[model samples]
Target: MSQATKRKHVVKEALGDFVTPTEKQQIVKVTGSRGNNLHEAVTARGVTFLVSMPPKFRKNLWIKRGDYVIVDPIDEGEKVKAEISFILYKDNIQYLQKQQLWPEGFTVEPDKEPEKAEETEKDEDFSGSDDDESDLFVNTNRCNYQYSESGEEDSQEEAS
Candidate 1:
């Protein structure tokens, strides 16, 4: 059958009404023009339903980003088949339904500026000199100290 004569079945979950931090959301019914003839098969509240409406109905509802709608299978206008969602980021309805990411309500909180960790530096006290020969200074670029003995620490290795 042609696209206009075809009915699309979907299970959309409402993602509430509010701008979120840019994430994939629900699929909404795109009602065509006057007598556009759009059909849908839905399931809600443990019961299946079917709806037949014009594509213009969808646009009039402003099924834009982040809008919650319902499409009932049986007695559509008289029943609730599934949550209405805007079909976004996909060409066909089936591709959008596969996402299944829309949550019942707003589960995520508003964006908050991340706090930067504060850094404090306290002087280290190495007052007493206890020489452990094993103190091989692998990292010396970031350190400043004078060896009282006045001997290059790695002289032995150089001589060998």
Candidate 2:
């Protein structure tokens, strides 16, 4: 049959609704295309649960990298078990993408950073003393003669 018709078969199992999804481990992956409700989930227990189309696909899309799905004690027609998985996700569309679990075929580039130059120790290069200030001088010319006139008031006193 055509793709649309083939999808209807995947939704409801040919064997009828006896699919038990309880503590059967979590659905590890979902594989199928859009407008196509038919998909299968490989559970942690290694058994694949043929998720009934449309309703189940809509509901079970939240089966992410880590989540628990419990099968209803009884089947509710094409929508056998309600996921409680809905409680895990805040939005519906996000739940779908997360459920796909195909980590490959996707690209993640490293974050860009501004490059920094490596630093090195610089040489100190200091001189011992300031030679420019030591070279300055002013002349003082009175060291050979002493002032000794009139220490006795109006009398000529000379060094004897």
- What local distance difference test score does each model get? 0.34, 0.36
lDDT of 1 at 132: 59
What lDDT would candidate 2 get against the real structure?
0.36
Model 1, residue 127: distance off in Å is 84
Q: Give, for candidate 1, the lowest lDDT window spanning 10 residues.
A: 109-118
Q: Estimate each model's TM-score.
A: 0.20, 0.23
Candidate 2 local lDDT, 129-154, one digit each (tens): 44565545634764646566756744
lDDT string for model 1 (49-86, tens) is: 32344353443333332322333233335533333333
Question: Model 2 — TM-score against the truth?
Answer: 0.23
